[model samples]
Target: MRPVASVSFDDLLRAHQGMIRAFLRRLCRNDALADDLAQDAFLIAHQRLGDLRDTGAAKSWLFQIAYNVYAGHARKHARRRELFEAQNGADLDDAAQPAPAGMARDIAMAMDQLPADVRACVLMCLSYGMSHSEASKASGLPLGTVKSHIKRGTEKLRAFLHAYQQA
Candidate 1:
């Protein structure tokens, strides 16, 4: 198979847009924000295409860029939340938008209840179908850590949902 260098970046974008959007949407749980991030990813990919030497790694490379964008966005929001909490003694969850109704919504809510790191792994693996190594590259986390997070996250989600169901 040819490296990603062999394909036009536009062609790459056309081919991967839906998958990228689905990955972001599942991660963000917001369609508009996911679309925005997908656009951001493509723009970043376009700018940095010259830097990548291995065309075969294009998909993973793009995912890593998207993950970086998401991480930056999350950090910015975290800072804002910290400032707000310091000022008003407000909990972050107080401002969280409610989850929508349905099985997906229920699962999303369960995911939300997990620790952040574990939630990231679970979503990357199960929700977005990213393999452990792929999730590791995209998250800047060690492979073992990604594996452990997915394991721990699975246990936690199962427990949480079982409890939620009994209620």
Candidate 2:
């Protein structure tokens, strides 16, 4: 078999850094942690570049690596709640940083109330500007299921916002 061509890691990072950061942020809900995880994803990508057969599929391959890293981090995190608690204590003051504010906070709270599947669908579609098919693939849901979740999630968000306005 022909050896894989050497790919420029810098070029790959420049092309996909923002997408990786945003995806990690959505998955983890912590900007600093997301940045760290995104970097880790890139490191993994660089290490495994030889395994990549199709340069055109780099985006999907990178994301799959990111998803795996995020999943592993989450699993390890769950196994070490005490470590998280200690970190949480250290970061309590940082938590007081001015929140999203006003309508944005309201919307975020409403979104937080959604079922996980619905929330993922809404964020992938609205935040990331992904089409239903793309969101479905990213979220690991069926296309129809992703569409339904987005529709229902949006309706719930609107109702919550409307009720909040009236109160």
Top candidate on lDDT is 1
Write the residue-wise lDDT of candidate 1 on 1-167 in tens digits: 56554778878799888878876766666678778988998999989888677776676777788878877877878887688899989645344344579876788777767766677778778876778998898789999999999999899888877887898
Candidate 2 residue-wise lDDT at 42: 92
lDDT agreement with native, every candidate: 0.78, 0.74
Task: Work out the TM-score per prediction.
Answer: 0.77, 0.66
The root-mean-square deviation over C-alpha atoms between each candidate and the true structure, in angstroms, is: 3.2, 4.9
Candidate 2 collision pairs: none
Q: What's the C-alpha lDDT at position 7 in model 2?
A: 58
Q: For every model in order, what is the number of clashing pairs?
A: 5, 0
lDDT of 2 by residue, 113-158 (tens): 7865677678767876667876666556689998999999999988
Q: What overall lDDT, based on C-alpha atoms, would model 1 receive against the true structure?
A: 0.78
User: How displaced is residue 5 in candidate 2, in Å?
Assistant: 7.7
